[model samples]
Target chain A: MTPPPAPVDDFDLHGYVDHQLPPARREEVATYLAANPEAAARVADYQSQNQALGAAFEGVLAEPVPPAMLTRRRPWLGAITRIAAALALLFTGGTAGWLAHDSLLAPSAIERTVAEPAAYAHRAFAGEFRHPVEIWGDNEPHLVTWLSSRLGMPVRPPDLNQAGYWLVGGRLLPARGGAAAQFMYQDDKGGRITLYVRTGIIGNSESRFQFFDQQGVRLVYWVDGPVGYALTGPVDREHLLHAAQLAYGQTKR
Target chain B: MDDIAQQISEQIPHLRRYARALARDRTRADDLVQDCLERAWSRLHLWQPGSNLKAWLFTILHNLHANQVRKLKRALDNVPLSESHLSASTPATQMQQLEVKGITDALQRLSEEQRAVVLLVGLEEMSYQEAAKVLDVPIGTVMSRLHRGRERVRQLLADQGQPVLRRVK
Candidate 1:
């Protein structure tokens, strides 16, 4: 009289291991595996394979991008390369004043620290329609508290309603052996943007907004006190800068 | 930088990662990425804006790698697994090194189709649909390739006498 278990096979097993199955179906697969030892062992093996692959190649992500790739691909980056070389020469015998001037003129390491990861995270998550964030914007208070504690500072999602974008939600992301927070925003017509914030930045006394148009994703980032903020969106530089200014304004208060 | 160039530059790290995994030699992998970037740059008009740029870039890399393979007409990895003997200097690091080397060997042993599916889904963390698009295969094909690829990797690791996951039950 009990209903027969749902038919599960290799496809379902792969889905279960890859976490591609829907929640309800995932639960069903879990139940099926409970009674099936062979399927369970296969799942274990698949899981380990994923972990091993991740362990093997993760270092590639941290490797410094080849200089030629960046400069040759975009001839304009050649200017930055020249500036960087000049800065290097200055470092040997330059005065502190020149050092500060060079910092303002050329893109520094701090900019890359904030923008690169922010750009990557935006590309990875901004397109997701389902499970876009760990916590929804509706739980604003709790979200603020949780992110603040984890980041070891008082974290707040900047209100961009004035700029026609409202907080959709946010999620915590790993950043350089520490925790970073990303807040997602949505406007009418479903245009999405993300504000990435990280604390404990060294040598980050303060910096004005720096603009970067990485591919099509526009970003405006700055350092304030102990934290760095990057606002990334698919919008143009003007619109992204407007939203970033709003975020910058709100966070300052 | 121009819009297209900036976008292409953004994907260099990921391209290098996938290429390194596929070619298994840093120099060859880097050359492949350079070729991919050049190809993408030349055909910038074909890349539709607002579409999946990462997938498009990946497809370019995949195609270049395929052509290279055809020209060479040799095995992707000529090095045998036996050559990667595990060192015994440090137990803690040795175990992880052994596992890493073992997985690399296992990946090289897989068929090109299976390896592409495995690395796309496993290393790049692409969804089944995305992996299919990049590989120019159907979703079902992606699933089957992933299953076989993962299973073969498991068997290869077990055969290597390296540490593998054991069933709890």
Candidate 2:
């Protein structure tokens, strides 16, 4: 005789189809499917849609990344160098000309410190089994004051609750010949993300926000005025950026 | 290539893949990728090191596509499905191909926002939250769009009424 089917009174079928359910919930979906043939068919149909979409677009990935996209940077820079070379040849009669390329390529001490430390500290402490943070987020004021004093600036733990993460805690980190601060947060889901804050690393200038994926962890970091921030998480890129944006907004304010 | 350039370059294939799904026209897709690459290259300094470059590129591509849609009064469409790729003459295989094309066509018929959520969540296999972040929308919006878009595709494909694999005995 067959056993009775499991109930899914509280399980989200949409979440199952979307594949966003956590493991145990996903298993619940699987169990639900085994009991109900119609629901199983619906899930199969959803899978086929995904399969069809994947198959159709699969060609695009095999096709070359279009040389134009790759070479976009070359033209303008090439044009400038060509023009400069032309002018030098015309004026100097075959003498080699200096292009000021060295200065442009060099990273300032502060710029070097900004991004590297955050990444380093993230990789180091993010995987810690215990003591992931030096100062827990329990006492917000103390964590802020302690990190701020160590970094020689008034730093505040950016409130990330809006972006679906609450402060798990923070840690003082050694980075780029200076002290940096790391604040951790977790969403209602088991997702964990951290904000790496380096203060007075650069002059008052704006920098672009960029993302990097190291191993499996995702990060997005930017520098603003004298503060550089990197938000790291083992979540998808969009989620990490959401946390990063929230942290930036909190710190900025 | 410099390390930064290499990292950025590595993301081009996936970017192209996403662009193709979004545009559904090879030339238009390539142009979108080109524009995205140019923007990324120019703003290279803005990208934070050790962060996700692929997500950044997708974000750029999504914004560009959104702006282009707005300007063109939303020409979001896909080329009609053709059986030209199918060489097999077996009736079963032909039916399979037809079903596949049916879903593809149905996907294109969705509204741009809904279609985007489907392609991102289905093809790219992004989490709902990731798609939301890329589209700059709330996760609830992503879920609704994905569910509706997916359900519509199923209806159009007759996945509920007509069995995709087996006929009613």
Q: A36-152, model 1: which lDDT tens digit per residue?
A: 999998888888787877777888878998786675444445446646645654565322222232223223344445666676677667767897788999999999999998887
Docking class of 2: incorrect
**Candidate 1 lDDT, B22-135, residue by residue in tens:** 877565577678767766766777988999999999998998777545432321122111111212123465556665488887887888899999999888888999999999
Candidate 2: where is the Cα deviation over 4 Å? Answer: A1-11, A72-253, B74-100, B159-169
- DockQ, Cα level, model 2: 0.16
Model 1, position B68, has a per-residue lDDT of 47
CA lDDT for candidate 2? 0.66
Cα lDDT, all candidates:
0.74, 0.66
State the lDDT of candidate 2 residue by residue for A1-253, as single tens digits. Answer: 9665356642256678667788887887888778889888777777777777777778877886656667656546755765664565447532212222211221222224544455556556665657877777888889888877787778888887777778878888765445678887766744566787775432226555655432232456776765678776566545566677777776773
Cα error, candidate 1, residue A61 (Å): 0.6
lDDT of 2 by residue, B13-87 (tens): 888888777766455566677778877877877988877677778889999877655532311111111132122
Which 10 residues in a row give candidate 1 chain A its minimum summed lDDT? Answer: A97-106
**RMSD in Å for all candidates:** 22.1, 20.4
